[model samples]
Target: ALAVGVAAAALLGFAVALTVTGLDGPEARRAAAPPGPAAAGAASRPAGAPDTDPDGAGTLREGDSGPAVSELQQRLLRVPDVYRDGATDGHYDAVLRAAVARFQLWYGIRGDESGVYGDDTRRDLESRTVR
Candidate 1:
């Protein structure tokens, strides 16, 4: 009888420990926020909805200049308090690179000043914009 009671107590203690530890774990918290209104709206809108660019990138058809370049330009534009020397012509010159580096710093992208705003940089840019 004593052994039976001890075993049951041990099981109860294990269950309580699991519940308490899991409650405070990292996965318990909700996500920070949904994606930007534009992107979220785009998905909900009808397929034929007007030419609104969902990603918050400016409206421009594919194959014009290049989607990658145009999207980068838009991301740069979205940076708050961003002061560009001139326009975002997709040139990726020193001026644009500097702007991107500043953006990287602001957005918490480590080592983003490599003069190449690749996939990681793009993801960081998008996440910041969405939030």
Candidate 2:
């Protein structure tokens, strides 16, 4: 009888371990991504937060949104006197477009009229940002 009880307990433990492990599948993980600061508090930050480049985020344009945008906004805000109204909202808006243009003009890059944060712009920003 004691042997049978131990076997049952072992089976129960195995089943539980399998259940927990199964919950970490891609679908389950995708279903559990929100409610953190990425979707909560940080989504609403003003235009003055310090940031790091989370991902390359493709090429940020007038409608893109991501941590890279946040970092760009922070870098622009570093020149407070120049970008007094820049926003760190993780979105590429009109204010960010203007700021990017100003940044491009300040760095003297020619022939870019759309104000898009492309590779050259990103490279210049990375080189010129003062921490």
Candidate 3:
């Protein structure tokens, strides 16, 4: 059983190496990197200005929830037939994602990913909605 034990040890060592190196690839590394100056600037709003951008990171997608999601729902409701259910429940569910995608299609908001409430979508929605 010495041969089997050696093979198991080798497998364990390979697994440890993989874990140490991380298998998530370059995208994970880039995401883990600290934000640059431009990203930092975009994350901060001017003093005394309204916090119109949801979540402050300027992006929201499915599975997010909070006041920001509620605000997004309200804004989407402002546009006719965009958020028909009109539930402002603070949860970014499938309905909200579909609404966001519909709004992006109707308004030509191609800068952000479809079904995502990114900076471009937020700017356009805020500009169109009442303060």
Instruction: Indicate whether candidate 1 or candidate 3 has the larger TM-score.
Output: 3
Q: How close is candidate 3 to the true structure, as a TM-score?
A: 0.58
RMSD of 1: 15.6
The lDDT of each candidate is 0.60, 0.74, 0.85
lDDT of 2 by residue, 42-107 (tens): 767766765433323356778889898899888878764646867788998888888888888887
Q: Please, what is the TM-score per model?
A: 0.42, 0.51, 0.58
In terms of TM-score, the best-performing candidate is: 3
TM-score of 2: 0.51
Model 2 accuracy (lDDT, Cα): 0.74
Please state the error at residue 113 of candidate 2 in Å: 4.5
RMSD of each: 15.6, 12.8, 12.4
TM-score-best of 1 and 2: 2
Q: Judged by lDDT against the true structure, how good is candidate 3?
A: 0.85
Best by lDDT: 3
- Worst 10-residue lDDT window, candidate 3: 49-58
Backbone clash count for every predicted candidate, in the order shown: 0, 1, 0
